[model samples]
Target: MTKTLALIAAAVLALPLAATAQSSTDAKPAAKAAAKPAAKPAPKKKPQVTRRAAKAVEEVTPIDTSTDVTLNEADLAVAGRVHTGKIQCELGADVTVTADESKPGYFTVSTKGAKYRMHPVESRTGAIRLEDPRAGAMWLQLGNKSMLMNQKQGLRLADDCQAPAQVAMSAELKLNPPKSLFEGADAPTSGPVKK
Candidate 1:
């Protein structure tokens, strides 16, 4: 009888421990679920900034307009040659160069969505060069063609640009190509010799 009583006491003591272990195991998952709710989807991101946006910002940015850049006679002469009005380029691109009446030797060069304030910059190669230092843009005008380049980006914006004079010059060049210096002078005629 005593052996049976001790057995019953052992079972009673073990019952509580087993119940607590089961409860703890059940509570862990519930606590975890409550502590960490389902992660909400990440919020959508804003659109990426664009080059056009940056350019727009640049337009609004204040810059000093008082600094007068004086040009000499040569620069003025070059400016006069700079073809104003719409000039066409290859790939159907066009640029409009308008001289500033208020500011001689100054021009506003525009294309598509961009505009630059340019001034004649003397060129050692005899090409007409207009530059907008702030914008890092340069316009090079040759006798038969012209090109606009972004010095900062190291890329050509427009090429083969032709004004009326340039168009005429190009046609003339096609009709009468320049003589090559390498070829020898024409041989004297067999029967005729200069006295």
Candidate 2:
């Protein structure tokens, strides 16, 4: 019985060594096959730019300041408000919105002389939206004549008020207004003045 058990243990130990020798012989052929250099990939071709396409690129000009830029009301209504709206918020605060004529994508929202510049952003739904990222506020245009203003602190306002056209500043006043700080004062002297 002892002799038989010893033979079984020796056979079990020898089995792993035989399998390892067989795997090593099998791996040599695979390693020799992998040692050969792989075939090189074909070089890529560059796209040709034709002269007409180059001329098409050169013919593109920047926005010309010489031409007058006008804002269409219908497009403005869909994207942003063309005119300003005076809103009374639920927090009992009065807010004023001034649409930028030169840049139709921006608006100025003012409250008690404090102004905030807001940019138009794509809304989740079909509503027109203006967002003030600094203040974490959003203004949604509900209809052609009404707007809903929302703040992060849960303050909301429904505004339908519109200011009269006369309240708008004239083009002359808006373009070249007098300087506020040094209207009457001369330029500061460079050094101490002589007696």
lDDT of 1 by residue, 140-185 (tens): 7878887787766666789889999999988998898765423534
Task: Return the lDDT, model 1, position 20.
Answer: 81
- Predicted structure with the largest lDDT when compared to the true one: 1
Best by TM-score: 1
In angstroms, the error of model 2 at 135 is 1.3
Per-candidate Cα lDDT values, in order, are 0.73, 0.50
TM-score for candidate 1, please give it.
Answer: 0.59
Backbone clashes in model 1, listed as residue pairs: none
